[model samples]
Each structure stands twice: as structure tokens, then as C-alpha cells.
Target: MARVPAGADLELDVQLEGVAEGVLVTASVVAPLAGDCARCLEPFTSVMQVRFQELFAPESAEPADADEQDAVESYPLDGSGQLDLEPALRDALVLELPLSPLCEDDCKGLCPECGVRLADAEPGHEHEQRGAMWAALKNYRAAGPEGSSAGEEAVPDGKAGPERTTDRTDTAPGQAGT
Candidate 1:
């Protein structure tokens, strides 16, 4: 047995049986690994354990039919009883990593105005002014038609432009009310 990373551990027990020309090996592994939080980008750790059954065929064995031998690996057992587990452990750690990690469910993230982490902000602190485009549109409307009231002008027939009229209500310089 090989030591897994401190974050995760691995435990494997194997039993081999001879079934005709092939050998069957059943094993299990338990381990831990570390991951980064997706939202706050903080480090987090988790544990995992998995069991698998695999069959090993002799180097001399050959399938008589065209059908493929599925889920079987052919290995020539070395003189030493030990089988290197690096590949299996690598796969286990990779599989255990989460698709997405988060330090908290609702991470406030950094404020757009000051780049301050919203998670640490003082309560009831108003966020800075952000909507400038809307203010500009309101100002445009308030300054309508060269700053004159609609009823006092004739609206220039089909021209669709502000009408200049000699009517006293419109011609009076101070009568314009926005």
C-alpha cells in the first residue's frame, strides 16, 4: 500500500483468482484531495473512496473470436509482488475534484466601485453611484424642444420640429416652464 496525499488517503485490498487463462483482481482505494473554491477562489479539501473490479489476462492468451475482451488488462507480473499504483491513484484524485467549489453559498465578491471585497463591507454602506446613462436621458427630456412647453407651440406642421410662434403665450420670454 502507498501513502496518499495528506488531504486524502487511499486503502486497497486485492484478491486474485485464476479463471481459466485470465486472472481477476478486485481492489478498493480511499483518498483525499484539495481544490480551489470557484467563487471566492479559496482552497478547500475533500475525501473520496472507490472500489473497482478488474481482470488481468496472461501475455500468451488470445481470443479465438473477433469479439473484444472488455474491461481486461494484460500485464506480465514481475518477480516482486508489488504493483505500482501511481496511475490508479492519479485517476482517483482527478475524479474526486469537484466541478465547481465555493467558499460560501453566497460570496459577495469584490465591489465594482472601489474593488473592496463585499464580504467584509460594513453593514448598510450604500454602494457608489453606478447608473449614469439613465441620468443623461432624463436631462435630455427636461430640455425638450429648445426648452419650451409643447402646448405653446404649433409643432411645425409635418416638419416634426419645434415651432416658432408669435402667439403671446409662446412669444413671452419668461413663459417657458420645463
Candidate 2:
């Protein structure tokens, strides 16, 4: 077992089959990692297990095959000709980490209207009021004196007369006192 820089552990166990030209590596991996959840902004820990088989091309291949041979890697063999499995097992485990993690099944996020934390909201918490501009307009329509219309005269349908005056007052500004 070997420890990586960020506290990840790598372990490898394998049986290497050496052919006339190349070596095959089979191994298992274990990894422990930490990440922040995307939705809830909480930390989470996870363990990942991976297993893989890698074919290692030999170093003595022809010069014309160098480009294709460079694409593959050859594992170093011990004095007894057994393949070392450490490097490949570590690589596979690191690739298995989640790009984005989620902390819980239901993460109530921040409120869009008020930017408050939705998960921590009170049972009947009312929203903040910025002062209702149209409060007088609404109150005027409700609960006026009974049988009293607010000067909205009903025009008789069959009668002909001058058009109803929409302007509340015709008094000139400076002549009102006289």
C-alpha cells in the first residue's frame, strides 16, 4: 500500500502473465476521497473500488511501431520477472471520483425572492415588507359607508346628456378661494 499526496490510499494485488512479447497486469484498487456537495454546500466522504487489466507492450518493439507503442505502457518487472502493480492501480482509482457530489436526498436551497436559507425558514415566517405603494387604493374599495357610492354617478342608458365628467375638479388653481 502507498499513500498519495492528498491522503488517498492505493493498494494493488495481481498475477502477471508474461507472454513471448508482452506482459499483462490485473489488479484491484481502493481509494478514499472527500468533496463538497453541489446543492447543500456540505462536506462528504466516499470510498471507491476499481479493478482493471492492462496490457504492457514490450520495450524492444520495432522502430516503425514507436508511435503506437508509446501509447501503451510497460510495467517494470522484479528480479524474479513478476510485474509491479502499484502505478496502474493508483491511476484507476483516481479516475473514479465523482466530478460533482450531492450531500443528501432533499437539499432545500436558498430562496430566490429573499435570498434566505429555505431549510432554516420558520413555520410561518412572513416575507419582509418594503412598504405597499398601493395600500390606500386597495383600502378605498373595501368597507366604505353602506349605501354611499363614492361619487360614481350612474348614467341612465336611455337619457341623452353631456358626457360624464371624469376630471374631479374644474376649478382654476389660483381662483379656488374666491
Candidate 3:
């Protein structure tokens, strides 16, 4: 989630050259960024710098070749001969921004159970592993009444107990035993 802070001033060094087909803009940018660490969720501040070159061509120009069409994105120039640099800056900075912004290269993050920072916790800090069935039963029992212990056998709504067995075989309407 790292991004440039609002109202932050950027350092832009650009050179606009008039080429045969269009204006070739070579620029170097430095932006101030602030965000939370993706691993440990801690606030951090950083600075990013990037250098890029792009061509601003007239709106009526066509792609020279198929390879050039895919490789170069020609930013269209307006008919009045004025161009805005916002779109170019936006594209360059957005592509250069890191997807996973880390406070440190080797951040250990946090403990899964106690929610403690892993780096601050003891080396052997861990929780007892419970079985899947045991964990589910424990959660289910906890959601019920406080007095309802696992040792007790509770019946269903219409009175089903040891007498109501599910092993009954289907019999004909008139016959009893085969």
C-alpha cells in the first residue's frame, strides 16, 4: 500500500527533445512515499527514484510496425500542440512502485497465535498443536451453555435417544419378515 503522500513535492529532471516523428521525453523522478509494512503491518516512510523515456506523438500518427506497436506506447499529443505530463508521470511511477513494501529485507513478521512480533519473541515461542476434530469440538462446546459439558449426551427436538436406531430395513406393505 505504499504511495506518495498528498501535497508532497516531487523532484523531476526532464529533457524534451524534438525527434523526427515526435517529442522524446527523458525524465528522472524522485517521489516521497509512506505506507505500512506488508509483513509486520508497521508504518514506514520511503523514497523512490525512477528514470524513464517515452515518446509523445501526434494524434494522427500510426504505428510504424507490429513490434514497435507492442513495445512503445505513443502518448497522443493534442491538436493544439500542448501536452500534459501528468499521465506520463502517473504511468512511470505506478509501474515502478513495489507491490510488497517491506520495512526491512529480512523482516520476520509476527507470531500467528499470540499476535506478538516474531523478532521480539523468544526463539522457541509456539503454541500446542491441537487435532482438527478436537479443535472443532472444543469450539462447538464453547458456543453452547456454560453448564453443558462434553460428558453429557443431549437429545434432539422430537425425543431421539438410544431406542431410535437408524438400522431399520425397508419392508413390504403387507409382509413383516422375509
Best model number under TM-score: 3
The number of clashing residue pairs in each candidate reads 6, 0, 0
In TM-score terms, candidate 1 sits at 0.44
Off by over 4 Å in 1: 1-9, 13-18, 62-76, 79-81, 101-178
lDDT of 3 by residue, 25-74 (tens): 89999999888888888878889998988998886674557687667677
Report lDDT per candidate: 0.55, 0.57, 0.78
Model 1, residue pairs in steric clash: 8-32, 9-30, 9-31, 9-32, 10-30, 38-101
- The estimated TM-scores of all candidates read 0.44, 0.48, 0.59
Identify the leading candidate in terms of lDDT.
3
What is candidate 2's CA lDDT for residue 98?
Answer: 60
Is 1 or 2 the stronger prediction by lDDT?
2
Local error of candidate 2 at residue 148 (angstroms): 20
lDDT of 2 by residue, 89-115 (tens): 656765665666555447565566676
- Tell me model 3's lDDT, rounded to 2 decimals: 0.78
Once model 1 is optimally superposed onto the true structure by TM-score, how far is the C-alpha of residue 60 displaced, in angstroms? 3.9
| Model 3 TM-score relative to the real fold | 0.59
Sorted by lDDT (best first), the order is 3, 2, 1
lDDT of 1 by residue, 129-170 (tens): 554656777788778756556633444432444343444446
Off by over 4 Å in 3: 63-71, 79-81, 118-178
